[model samples]
Target: MSLFYLLAVILIASAIFTITQKSPVYSVVGLLVNFLALAALYFTLNAEFLGVIQIVIYSGAILMLFVFVIALLSSGVGPFRAGPNRLPRIAAPALLTTLVAFGFLIFGIAQRPFGPLPPHRPTSFLGNVGDPNVFGSVGDFGVALFTVQLLPFEVTAFILMVAVIGVVLIAGDAVPQPTLGRHRPQKRAAEREPILKAPAP
Candidate 1:
């Protein structure tokens, strides 16, 4: 219980730091810590598969992507602040969203009956949907994803595929020349084309 509380504190603190930090790199690091703390909390709850997935998918893959984007955008080795925030407009929406989410979490926790969890054992996904042993385990998640949510899963995959293709198209060197901004080495006055104007008729 003490370990759980400790992990929970770290998770909340890191999560707060992730949002409040001025530096993008620091924010990413805080988020990584937050993810690890969440994984540890899952381990305490006996959800080993969830913990592994949290570490592998979120901390490993997602955080790596964030770091890569940070590196790509950063001019300096340390603390390159990110994008447009003329009035820090996102801060308002972010704060409101966090408050709503926190309210939901508090309400849910208050409504939930707290008690010690029962002992677990290995069981197949096929039987006993009511008291399934596969619950909280990776196999159950896989079964749910591949079975009940199959259509949504396929749609999500297709959307992701389209997104990747769009990124490739945007990043490739063969961008259309017409839309590009004109640069220096100005054309000589004689060489420049004159616009034809109709005399008032």
Candidate 2:
């Protein structure tokens, strides 16, 4: 239980850090931490295949792609706005709605009557007749992914492909200098004019 809590905390913190981080590289690192945490959680849950997939696909491949795209597109750290904005106001209602929805979901789940939980071993279907305890096994994972979650799996793969294509398209061209937002950004070190020192009398 403590391990579960620890993993959950790390995952949430890393996810928040990913979004809140200033440097894109640092953000990517934070996301990597999130991916690692998720993989660990899967391992704890005895989902070895999912843990491997999480580490290989998300942490190794996708994040490397993100880093490559960022490096290819941007020359250096660019100017960023520094001030309060309407973004929080826009997100607040959606966040509140989601929280309320989750509250209802939890309440509903808690209301269900409890039964004697199955044994600690994994469960398997008759199709793989030889292996009785094959839950989270490769065969079970493959069956579920192809049969039950086929559409979602395909959609996710398509989305990833589109993201890669989009990144390549954007990075292939010379990116334009971004215009400052409502707030004036601080001048870069090279951009600031040095003050002339007065000669000693």
Candidate 3:
């Protein structure tokens, strides 16, 4: 088998393990491994920028968040109960739909005409910087991001900030209060007597 196919199988296996693992910590680690495998796949596809982003954003930031959340909630052990049931009620219909979708996708792929692969041209960034004449460069991406996609990026940042705030609020301790029917005792001079007093002649 080709290396690509081997990596794809490993990626799929890791993803399955990630979902099936009972422990949240192990699941997060599996997800991290899956992300790294995806990054490798992206590198194989010649998408270096996307691969780096996958490693930095998904593997680094998001996985760290998951780890932190697991550490905060877990007590170094699995839960007694595995929580509520997640099985779908209409399993038969869901399975039939999935099979039909897979069949249609395979039929579409089979119907595609095969042709000789086109030759690849080297991509250059420095040569096209600030050209305004050619496209497909780092400058073009920067321009698009700042001008066209600025609002979406801003919204995403706001959403992340709100999520962080929500997590913090949920993890914070509740306000302390006196026990039921209990009152604070008043302080008196006698009650406040010093433990050590100087002896007088």
Candidate 4:
């Protein structure tokens, strides 16, 4: 229980830190910390598969992709220009959507108020629906992911792909055409030069 509370605090703090930072690199670091804390929270909930996914997929892969994109955009090859503020125009609609979602969340919580925690069960309990040995085992999670949550899973992948592309489109305009063209031939020639000069075996 205490551990859960600690993890929750860490999660909240890291989330706030992630959003409030001015620097994108700092924000990414904070988000990485948030992901770690959320994974710890999943483990405390006995969802090992979720915890692992949170770490491996979100932290290891997606977050690293974000870092890589930031690094690529920040490379001194071109000036980083700020894009138009799309958020200001969408603020009203976004606020309304958030409020509606919050209302629904509150209604659901009221419908099933959390009661006291049940007595601790033994570690050997095989009470999951699909898997008998563990509640959040990889097999059970895979079955649920494919059978029940496939749409959301695919949507998530699509969203990530779109986000990466959008980031590139937004910031990729900074690179001058002449610089890119010059670098490409140099890089290609450098690649071939080493091979061309190699002694025949």
Candidate number achieving the greatest TM-score relative to the actual structure: 4
Quote model 4's TM-score: 0.62
lDDT of 3: 0.74
Better of 2 and 4 by TM-score: 4
Task: Indicate whether candidate 2 or candidate 4 has the larger lDDT.
Answer: 2
Candidate 3 on 1-201: residue-level lDDT in tens?
287897899799999899789888889988988999999876675556667889999999999998877876665453333466655666688789989999999999899977754345334332334443333334555665677678987999999999999987876654454578678677798888678867988
User: Could you tell me the TM-score of candidate 2?
Assistant: 0.60
Model 1 over residues 1-201: C-alpha lDDT tens digits?
Answer: 699889989988998899788899999999999999999987776567889999999999999999988887775654356567555777789779989999999999999887764566443333443336546566666676777778988999999999999999876755545635666578899999998999999
Q: Clashes in candidate 3: how many?
A: 0
On TM-score, the stronger of 2 and 3 is 2
TM-scores for all candidates: the values are: 0.61, 0.60, 0.56, 0.62
Candidate 3 regions with alpha-carbon error over 4 angstroms: 75-83, 88-97, 121-201
What are the per-model numbers of colliding residue pairs? Answer: 0, 0, 0, 0
Predicted candidate 2 versus true structure: per-residue lDDT over 125-168, tens digit per residue: 32443344666767777877787778989999999999999998
Provide C-alpha RMSD values for all models, in order: 9.3, 11.5, 7.7, 10.7
Candidate 2 stretches with Cα past 4 Å from truth are 76-89, 114-116, 122-132, 146-201
Best-fitting candidate, scored by lDDT? 2
Q: Is candidate 1 or candidate 2 better by TM-score?
A: 1
* Structural RMSD, model 4: 10.7
